[model samples]
Target: MGGLIFWKLRGSDEKPVASVQPPPPATTPQVFEQPPPPPPPPPPPEEDAGKKPAGKVVGVGGGGCAGECKGTAGATLQSALAAKAGAARGCYERGLRQNATLQGKLVISVRVGPGGQVCSAGVASNALGDPGVASCVVGLFRSASFPAPEGGCVDTQVPMNFVPKGGGK
Candidate 1:
């Protein structure tokens, strides 16, 4: 009766189809991964870590021209002026030709923009006794380039001394 039932199900006298096979076992052994070790603890703060807070000024002396300038801005301006020293000297010499007695200091106040550009410059003090020389010095400073300062702008003064080529009155 079982054979008759099988024949009825297949409805043919052909050999029965091979049974479906299960997938082969994995050749490599499975790995049980361990979670990564906890991250290292943060380093301890230094003794002088909080000496100067991120945004506060500690002391007020170490800066440009009586603490008027700060950071690399002062150095940047100094170097820029130093680079153009020849031009400034030329201006002074020209003024000397006009008046052989031209000898003194010219203090220039400069305003530097945030993008390392000279916004404006003017003669703060002029002991040279010549407006032409003062104006020329101010123009030279205005054309100078400095490194961008951290703050919005930098206001600083530079003094240039002019001495007569020949020591005379």
Candidate 2:
């Protein structure tokens, strides 16, 4: 019974002790801190950068700038007519806009230069609503002429409209 009691005393750890040594200091887990976020991107340059150019793009589509080509000193009547015809063909085909077809005539006014390039062009539709046709017509105008038109003028009536079985604006 004495031996058993001694063994029990040595084996036991839950019982209170008369003289107790302080427990080792507790250790806490290390923490990690996150880095700061990156800076934002810069903005784009403005359209009118203050020192204004002579003109801006009012309206444009399909190709180059409208008044980009400076009309040369003079242009021939033949060249003007040729320009008109070619423009007409392209306009006719492209006139087939979405879900609709149209037909009509218009007057195409162009200011040409001696170099045969079209300085500027305008279309007065005899019949309206074929936007595609007008676009195609203008597409023909771009880069088509060589020498510019003569100072006087060349005005002609052109059929600027949509046609049979194609599309609408």
Candidate 3:
């Protein structure tokens, strides 16, 4: 099955299971007076495959939009969730305008303990370019929490898109 990994791998040295594939050399060298150059050679196997592909990382900082994360309970908790959504939108929009190649959505599930503490957090949905920004967001929500609404448990899902506003750079 296809699974997502939201890991804090910044500066994490890559441990190649196999040899790294080198990119194909450009066949078309634009030399004036020279005939049109040939097409570039095919890239080597997995030349462009790896963690954190060429894409912008859109960070999200809220939970609540679909109410599928934190359990639903009271007005304060609901309001906090709404606030979280707005924050996520801001972060996404900022990333989009930066000419970054964003093309995915990430949903972060924040778990609030009985005492209204952020006890745990995980990625709910990682797709498109979603997983790219998960690590950064982990720290953003580490200190966040919403009181358990009085009704049932509350689990909020805050999703952010990584698709750049324009195509890509």
Candidate 4:
């Protein structure tokens, strides 16, 4: 049986050779010109930093001044805060996951340096009763940029009223 199987497998006694022969060298040197690459794609559209947040974020006026601490314009602070409304809403929304009905007033105290940098920021007062939301909102303010305060450092309080979508304020 072994001899019969070997005979059947070795039926083709001729050895098979596989080889690829390279093309003969060209008589004249060839010069090929490659086409120029396509122009770089246009930059993506920038997000609207001023876009209003989905949640209700009513602006309140309370830019009181203290000794040596100048008070910035409410409109200026409001514009800066409006730019960050979406992020603030994000913080509120994150807390909403924990408490679906999390909504209240938040007074964020921010100190802006003469160079328009946030020197310090914190939750001056939070009625939301959610520490996570308060911390998140404060964090957003910490990295927020604003117009340079005239004269010296300016301390401002931004009062924001938060109400969930479709909910009464």
Candidate 5:
């Protein structure tokens, strides 16, 4: 009875269908180069139109270190961040691919351990509006190594400004 049921289910002359498979992906990836950005537009004609611009007084101000660091620690930390600026810019450029007018300031708070290793880092303030970009920049700072501080752990703020090409926004 089981054999008869199997024969009936197998059907009297139906052909078995073959399954189709998709082709494999390419071994090498393709890369496309981006064109250079255009030059900035000329500045608007003198607003005052023949009147000498009034001179303004500028004042310089700064406060003491925010952490136990002293001496050239701040400068050293800034220099280290500058070294990674290009990478951070790359992150912003990736975001610009999504939003052409994306532009803002990201204040990164970084804490460096005694061995010149980054203990913790995060975006203290992110006006860029792109969480992915902010996270990428923070990851870069977190993996970076700054100059050891004179005292113990050093905490500092690194401000990075991202402006799209041609200064859109």
Candidate 6:
């Protein structure tokens, strides 16, 4: 037949398909509001205006020198070196004797024991190449002594500049 016609059976074994539905309309998203932040804590109260602030007094020495004993470590080392300046000069003189043209700077570290005696000494920096000169300088420092520190030992580094006699500037 030119135009075909199809017939449907009502009581067939095949099941009917479900119909499709259109999607729901779009809507604005809901937002949950957050609570405000807590306030900052109050500052501590100021001290009494009439009363002076309490402070611990650190005494380097007894009586009159208590307050004037600033930088005791340095002062002690300096005084100790001053007491041994002559011997240190001698060591430098010896170095000069070895090499008439020897001129440079030497830095040495000295450790003062608890009993105020130099426990050890070593050259920290040396521009002078002579081992004899270095050893002489170290020996001079090792024989020096300093005032005993409050409770323990003290260490200090001293820098010495060497220049030949009659050398200018």
Computed on alpha carbons, the lDDT of every model, listed in order, comes to 0.70, 0.51, 0.56, 0.73, 0.71, 0.63
**Candidate 4 lDDT, 1-169, residue by residue in tens:** 9999899889778587888899998699788999999999875544343332111122212221223566554567568766775569888888888898788999898877655667678988989899988988899998788876666568878787888889956
Estimated TM-score for each candidate? 0.52, 0.42, 0.43, 0.56, 0.55, 0.51
Could you tell me the TM-score of candidate 4? Answer: 0.56
Record all residue pairs in model 5 with backbone atoms less than 3 Å apart, i.e. clashing. none
Tell me the tens digit of each residue's lDDT in model 5 across 1-169. 9999999988867887898888897688767888889999876668543232121101111212223544335567667777786679999989989988889998888766555667578889999889999999988987777776545556778888888777744
Give the per-residue lDDT digits (tens) of candidate 1, residues 1-169.
9998998988876787999999998799888999999999776676356543321232322332223444345566568756665478888888988998789888888766555666568888888899998888778877777776665457767777789766734
- The TM-score of predicted model 6 comes to 0.51
User: In candidate 3, how many Å is residue 122 off?
Assistant: 1.1
Candidate 6 lDDT, 78-110, residue by residue in tens: 776765644566777887877788877778887
How far residue 119's Cα lies from its native spot in candidate 6, in Å, is 2.0
Off by over 4 Å in 6: 1-74
Worst 10 residues of 3 by lDDT: 51-60
By TM-score, the candidates rank as: 4, 5, 1, 6, 3, 2
What residue runs in model 1 are displaced by over 4 Å at the alpha carbon? 1-74, 166-169
What are the per-residue Cα lDDT tens digits for candidate 2 across 61-167? Answer: 22223334432333355555665665575556555445343565655656553334454666765464566666667656654664434432233334444355444
Report the Cα lDDT for residue 14, model 3.
59
Runs off by more than 4 Å, candidate 2 = 1-76, 97-101, 126-128, 151-169
Give the Cα error of residue 151 in candidate 4, in Å. 2.4
